[model samples]
Target: MDNPSLFEQLGGERELRTIIDEFVDRVFDDVMIGFFFQRASRERLKAKEYEFAAEHLGGPVTYSGRPIAQAHAAHPIMGGQFMRRLRILEEVLEAHDVSPAVREHWLAHTEGLRAMVTRDSGGRCDPVDAMKRVQERGKE
Candidate 1:
């Protein structure tokens, strides 16, 4: 028989939910990539995250999130910030004891989105803050 899908091997929706939760928490606590997600809703983010991961891993779910470029439009995201987020996910997977092969598959899926995630790269950043102040005065 063919090998189980990565979604199945990784334990499906339940495990994905756990991973997404931990990933979100870590991202929020991270100095590098937290600002971009500070105003986001945990529930909505988890939903989109689960859908995206599930679909990408060959699960029977469809992702309803905006296209990558559209989703990140006008954001001051950079390659380093994207890599920071990627590192958080990698750590989460390692914490979950994901096998080496599975981790490679998941990471490969992530690397595929670098273009969209780093579309706004190549800007100089403030060393003192290391963050973009893209938040409007009243967007809070």
Candidate 2:
């Protein structure tokens, strides 16, 4: 049999939605990163989260909002906040029992967006620095 697409690996859009919802819920509860999403409407954010996961999982890209960089451009730079959010997101995925391969794939895809999002957010934060911080934290 041919290898399954990432979308299939993730159990399609419904499963992706479940994962996204769980992950975003964790993000919302996080004191360090919750502020970034504080003003966003819950339903709208949930929909966007589903769309983003669908796109990343190799499903249709229905995310019609501004590019991530543009969307985050106005957020303030908070030292290691972005990295902290990523760590939280990873933990959330793990808590949901996402497969290792699927989690790794999603993390790799998200890492590519860091530079664009950070630069767009009007933050001088370096993506490399953020990545380093995450790695350092993982070691502790």
For model 1, what is the alpha-carbon lDDT of residue 112? 78
- Judging by lDDT against the true structure, name the best candidate: 1
The global Cα lDDT (0 to 1) of model 2 is 0.76
Give the number of the best model, judged by TM-score.
Answer: 1
- The TM-score between candidate 2 and the true structure equals 0.77
Candidate 2 lDDT by residue in tens digits, 32-131 = 7788887888678878878887777778677777888788779863436767677877887788778899899988887767776663342435467778
RMSD of each: 8.7, 5.3
lDDT of each residue in 54-118, candidate 1, tens digit only: 99888999999999888987677876777777789999999999888778988988877877767
In order of appearance, the predictions have TM-scores of 0.82, 0.77
lDDT of each: 0.82, 0.76
Off by over 4 Å in 2: 119-140
Considering summed lDDT, which 10 consecutive residues are worst modelled in model 2? 118-127
